[model samples]
Target: MGRFRPGAETDRFGIRIAASGNGVHVTLCRPGRRPCIWLHLATAGTVADKATVDDRPEIAALARRAPRLEARALECVRNDRVLFHDLDAALEPGQVLQVEGPNGCGKTSLLRILCGLSLPGAGEVYWGDAPLPEVRAEYYEALAYVGHRHGVKGELTPIENLRFHRALAGGTPDRVPGDALAHLGLEGFEDVPCRTLSEGQRRRVALARLLMTRRPLWILDEPLTALDRSGVAVVEGLIRDHARSGGMVMITTHQAIRLEGCVLGRLRLGG
Candidate 1:
């Protein structure tokens, strides 16, 4: 059995809990009908605990009440015409939000607004409880963005680019740059300048930064563009893993995204 210490987190019932492993053991208490949860290791021959309220989809949705990113009544206008308006949304941990719409429907514009690169014509974007401007430094530290234009520097090799990215992040890297490159299927091409690589390979280089940064929030615009089937699968896996680990993602893509084991929400623009 895994031991659980007191954690700062509390649910609606004010249950204090700490977690360390895969299994959850809950003991029901009488009188007030409160429940105590125990953290358990997944050992052989141990009867796996049945799904509890925390595992139920409906309860999980209610439990995700804290917003990491929120947009309230956001309106976008280009060429003096409103593209989208009255858009209120929030991103919580372990959630993947897919922004979907037709061409010129302001999907990219919405992403830019959420990223704080572009402002909405009306309304506001907030990180946690405060507006984005007030928490720019802290928010950016947790943000990783990939746009339609591949951000890879053409003159730099994949390894060099990833190293530069790590330096900019200013922390101990989660993995070596070469390892990230190879994981993205750029094994032999790690030393070659990004300028000489194919467009798909360049896209892979930009995507590899996501692995190295390990940021909690990812804002991706057309992340699957110019990639083969295998590359697309790799990105899907990355997004799924990130969400499973309690990371949030905001992505705009025309392709259907197949994900499992996390809450997925779709926001349609210009509809």
Candidate 2:
């Protein structure tokens, strides 16, 4: 532990400290005050002899910066009637919005509507004041979606799978660097065939796309299924950094994800 500086920076959700002990502990969290994961910054004694803390003044300057909401909706419904009503909400860039509820509660359906993959029965969804369908191309360009499936090709190698994903997403092949694979702890298996990988390893390969895709909005469904502690840390860091950089995220998970400084809005199904 080190001397804690509370409220040192406004936009900063967590604190950075220069620890005199073995290492500095950095906790990644969502804006909703939930703990996502923890990061251990090894002290200078390990790899290097000394380290310096970056000045907080620059971070403090961002305190006044507010994220702009790019999406707005008046109401949402399904099948020409109200499935879930009064869905008035605004999603700001750089915000992490979590959707929680029981099974078949329209959580996934709602996300589909938001992403314009499906249309709302009655209400409308807008992207920066324009109708979602009108800006579908622009919206898709800014969005990255991950559903229940890992979405990786079983016949392709890890690198090949990532390359295919990039191509399908209209991005150049090999756009994702090798570091992305290493970050997910998939160093040796980068060139290995996907079918031979374990379930967890396959999931890691799918998750590796998060680092590769730089889309602004992340719509994820149950993203933490096969991840271990370190894998969870990687995802948490990705979410934190995405929000900090003015990107938006919408995630639905049965397990609790501890996040801090996030403006949490929820839609509970079945009441």
Candidate 3:
């Protein structure tokens, strides 16, 4: 590990990756409290060098950064119809990959494959320098996925629903559930059961998970669905903040999302 200089150009979270002779090394440095942690990515198999699983988001964050995500030659076929062919894409820290096309272009299908929810007809997905199969568990741990379904239980309140999500993940919560709800404009409505909330509110409730959890890679499908003007802006702000914090997001939307300073790479399917 190199020396940590104050006011240094460290990453927002002080992440630095350097390649070594046999493997790659990752270092996540904080200002002065914890020493810089040096972890190596093995050329094969599970990472022998892993931080102990703890209930702290920082520790988990450190563990997830070394491996970047990549998808290559991805092809999908459904019932003899070619959804997409030989799709290739990559997303690194502080970047966004926007998958856009007309309806029935397989935008959602590609996202599902990227997040490991479904398998591709043919292609390879890499996590860091390793094939995804070798690091499946680790990859999923570092990923956050939001699809068309709100995934909110109608019987649960916004707070309860978010709490349930956090519990299922079993990791440290980034923010209090109530705080996440409030941040998404659900302050007075937190206690109300989700069934009573409108479609937009339910979507907001689901979006709140992005605030309450920390994950390096976000794969979203129709993220702005059912959102109003302000809600769309809120979602955009979240994407910007996440990228600025050294996280990567892959999104699919119908309308163009223009972020003044953020560079968006587009993947348009079905020419």
Q: Which prediction has the highest lDDT against the true structure?
A: 1
Candidate 3 ranges beyond 4 A from true positions: 1-36, 39-65
Task: TM-score each candidate.
Answer: 0.77, 0.68, 0.79
The C-alpha stretches of model 2 lying farther than 4 A from their native spots are: 1-82, 171-175, 261-263
Give all candidates' CA lDDT scores. Answer: 0.77, 0.64, 0.76
- The residue pairs that clash in candidate 3, if any, are none
lDDT of 3 by residue, 116-206 (tens): 7788999988888888888998787678888898699999999999999988765567789989988888889989999999999999998
Q: Model 1: which ten-residue window has the lowest total lDDT?
A: 23-32
Is candidate 2 or 3 superior in lDDT?
A: 3
- The sequence of per-residue lDDT tens digits that candidate 2 reaches over residues 154-177 is 888999888777766764322464
Give the total clashing residue pairs for model 3. 0
Candidate 2's error at 227, in angstroms? 1.7
Q: What is the clash count for each candidate, in the order shown?
A: 0, 13, 0
The sequence of per-residue lDDT tens digits that candidate 1 reaches over residues 1-271 is 0111223444322333332244332322222345554333333423223334343444344333334899999999999989999999999877899999999999999999999999899999999899998999878877889988867999999999999998887644668988898889999998989999999999999999998875779999999998899999999999998887567999999987788776899998877
User: Candidate 3: what lDDT?
Assistant: 0.76
